[model samples]
Target: MLNNYPLLAKVESPSDLRKLPRQQLKPLADELRAYVLDCVSKTGGHLGSNLGTVELTVALHYVFNTPEDRLVWDVGHQTYPHKVLTGRRDRMLSLRQRGGISGFPRRDESEYDTFGTGHSSTSISAAHGMAMAAKLKGESRKAVAIIGDGAMTAGMAFEALNNAGIPHGGLMGDLLVILNDNDMSISPPVGALNKYLARLMSGNFYTAAREGAKSVLKNTPLYEFARRFEEHTKGMVGPGTIFEEFGFNYVGPVDGHDLESLIPLLENLRSRPGPQFLHVVTKKGQGYKLAEADPVKYHAASGKFDPAVGFVKAATPPKPTFTQVFGEWLCDMAEQDAKLVGITPAMREGSGMVEFHQRFPTRYYDVGIAEQHSVTFAAGLACEGLKPVVAIYSTFLQRAYDQMIHDVALQNLPVLFALDRAGLVGADGATHAGNYDIAFTRCIPNMAVLTPADEAECRTALTTGYQHTGPATVRYPRGAGVGAEMTKPLTAWPWGKGEMRRHSARPQTHGRGTPRIAVLAFGPLLYPALKAAEALDASVANMRFVKPLDLELVVELARTHDALVTVEDSCIMGGAGSAVTEALSAQGLTLPVLQLGLPDEYVEHGDPVKLMSLCGLDAAGIEKSIRERFLSAPLLRSVANE
Candidate 1:
């Protein structure tokens, strides 16, 4: 599929790549860079991060013998180039599509992908484990973890580093950590370490010694003296004594884009012993001119686009996304309540808090990539009587579930969790899907989980969650809602309630007698269930609350209808549908319940609508499933009565 990459075409795997001359590696990197842009542009995916890691990825695969020696990538969105070079060049066109190559590093997909990572900052721990395994086996294999500065912001990175860098570490040696410091994440990275790294660029002695050492002293023990001198001088005089104190040799402040610099340094680090940290600097969106100029816009590159023309706005006014609707509500809510404060785990952009940040700069807190810290941090704010609204994706929020339970829920803190990306997140696939949120959050005590059906309801739910005395969460899907006209003057909707949308119990059917089925729809699946209910002549209720779950209405519906069908855009296991069954059982209520949701297996990446249809969550699929599963019981009853 990548047609014109002559140098890249030769590299079938890391073995063929190792055979190439050192001088040709740069050219190969160039070819790989071009190919990545071409591939991702055609099929929309992570563009800028992959562009940044071109030479670094090439240099790592080139220097190290992969499959035997592990190369772990942290927050594996930057692995497109790595995927291309490592035996998946032909299948590059199928990246992120259903039944094709995964966007992240999947261990099942390739032997070269030593560890799977979609979330951030687990690379060090995984790579270090491999190193320890090699040591235990008495093998000479090496392990390298390529982690970005953004990933380093997570508490786990330091936890791994703290253990890996200690003298008594189980396996401290032969482990190399290549810090890919691009100075940019999805949102520009924040924290003290970012400031520390920004200042770490000032030391000039390491670069000078690296460039001038071997050439200047080609004669004697002085050459060894110079190399030792570089370390001693840097530790004593330079700013990187922190790594030295941690018991690992620190290298670089080197150019990550320059293959000449990266290749030799990597080769040297590979031969050495003990944990080595190499900090290489590179620009995000390095090769592509358009992406380089505006990396954030080209982050995912959105849908298919002509790379030459770049991103273009559609002529017609686009529908506001669920994120945008949340943003509007957030801004309005902040204006109304003085105690309102916004917090995100390095997701200010993705969580629809850009305008909220601008308007309430003093109240906005970007807590780096630390999701655990974000949840606990919100609890701290809530203790002071401030209403802290945590803007987070449902999947990412899983990282801080313990904190959600212990810090907020147990204590009954009034922290509003505005959970964005609450359903199948489409192209990002199962790792990022909000399918588990309903299941995960509903089980926690003192938590109100609200899922909005439309944009207008999304706004009302936020207001309601804000007004609630304890921890409340609003779960919504990823993109635009079914165009509901937003109302002004923020108003709180009734808490723990559901409304009947359609009531057609025992209505006249075309042929045989119809089934008495009550379609209790949860979250955004209300529309689809409505359509399914129409043909079946069943009653439909829009159950807005997953928790405190409209118990009265649910009991009444179960008593009235012969069968109850619960529909949600989440996992069937421990989800809202499960809650319905549990609620029915608790109240001495017995009903034939059909639970329809995401299956036990992980859903693959593709078009959202198509994936939903495939998962049997769409209108047609829901209708077919309801008819087959529940309608049969009523049909049998009618035959017996007849």
Candidate 2:
């Protein structure tokens, strides 16, 4: 379908896009959007954000000398169009798949992706760094950061603005900060700033002021002075007024979709000196009627569907995602326990807390992309005897590590952390992967971590974490579980315990003629481990607890098996495998351990199986690694000989 557009299909690079006539740009954008929708529908990635940025992306690449003039995309969810235009058109189908282009901008992936970004609100800071570096090196390269209006709510964006506003060493490098106002960040963006900006941009005061200033300036003898005065007057009128205070030359409330307006404005800004701010208004799903009407539903989609009817909802037995499970648990617990409160950092919809917010508005707090504040806020609520359940992604929680340790763990605050996406999150790639949460959280004192093997266990774990008195985390993987019947009634499992799901018949090599070689799996990845174990003729243990080590099970398994393999969907370093090794070492038991998990390097975005295999966490990979570690090379043989 995209090949039909000669202007688009012929353009392999941004340089090619720059040569196209202004009149043809809209058709090119249309083709780009169509191509994105088609590709994402098949691969399933961030759809709505990319669809929205199609024009903006084309305009940016066309205007800027990319690979030299750095364009840092905040959050990078909107970088799909950027990727497609930047010589990655042919490989678009392989996006977010293992060994393919990442869903988010990756510096390693392409030179055009000057800076890698996954989390929100980092673009300004990154652009500031690039701008500063260019100034220091005496280079004339421009640094432009395109951030969404939703991302602007983040504290880091403002912090970067404050820094960029300050003149550095008497040399002011050009930093163009384009605020792509889509008016939605995952959910309808929250906070006073978002509301204030929305109102200020929409108001007719700017229009009236500009018209009045033009008439007065044209008639007056002091034209330059009047123009300066007019600009100064504009500072008090609208949203750009606030940015002007931050020491930037404010431009626009321009139509982002209009190439005629956007191109000239960008050209003017490109020639200007110092920090320039452009507030471009854009729709979340521009062009596509269905997506435009309901952006949130199509925020990220699976792949090509009937644009007329929109995305085809996957027909499945109505089952809850881990996020839904946590959301339901929070509301259910809150209904019974008045002290139970819910907290999220600008992820109300993603974390599945929208219904909870509606039901318990007073008790639910959306902290607006402030992870650090969310953790500390939970700590404060905990101090006051209110049980605060922080529903955060494993990747996002990394932002508040100090707060988690100092505010919650050190003080032993009863903050139940419902960690969603606690494993290799497919498509979103390395940046969004929840691989390090287990390693980091488990090391903290007075911290408890639980991993659910299935959907039923996920519900139980959330309740279990909620009932606990100190800092606790119930980490669950992304997506649905292995069709296990979900049980009602929040039954609490014993903390730091493991359940043997299946046992081996033959005495494994690890045990003296005993069926002992066992696979200890954590989180939802346990299903694959169990399946692999069945083929390997080894025991499978659902090690529900990550922290506290499940010592009893560990000791028993150590005594029974000569070799033990720990498998998890997390980083091997300082993770489940490391925990098991620590436990066994403390007991003075020396067992050959084979750790099967995500590697030290970042795993690229792709299919879950492909990612797992790449990281040696898949069924075949796990079996092969274990067999190689235990059977192929016996360390005990060499030790005995020595």
Give me the candidate number with maximum TM-score. 1
TM-score of each: 0.91, 0.89
Mark the regions of model 1 whose C-alpha exceeds 4 Å error after superposition. Answer: 1-3, 167-173, 184-232, 235-239, 505-513, 633-642
lDDT of 2 by residue, 1-642 (tens): 555667778898988988888788998998899888778766778888888888888888888898799999999999989998998888888887777788888887899999989999999999999999999998998999999987887888999999999888897778999999886332232334443443343335644675577787786787778767755665443356678779887765666777766776677778767898887778887878888888888887755566667777678665667788777877788888999989999899999999999999999999888899899999999999999999999999999999999999999999999888888888787788899999999999999999998888988888888888899998988887776777767788887778999888866453333334878898877888887887788888899998877899988887766678899888899998999989888877887788888888977777776777777777888888877776665345213211
Superposed on all Cα atoms, model 2 deviates from the true structure by an RMSD in Å of 5.5
TM-score computed on alpha carbons, candidate 2: 0.89
Alpha-carbon lDDT, every model: 0.85, 0.82
lDDT score, residue 174, model 1?
A: 71
Worst 10-residue stretch by lDDT in candidate 2?
Answer: 633-642
Distance from true location, Cα of 297 in model 1, Å:
1.5
Please provide, for model 1 over 379-494, each residue's C-alpha lDDT reduced to its tens digit, 9 standing for 90 to 100: 99999999999999999999999999999999999999999988788888877888899999999999999988999999999999999999999999999988989999898878
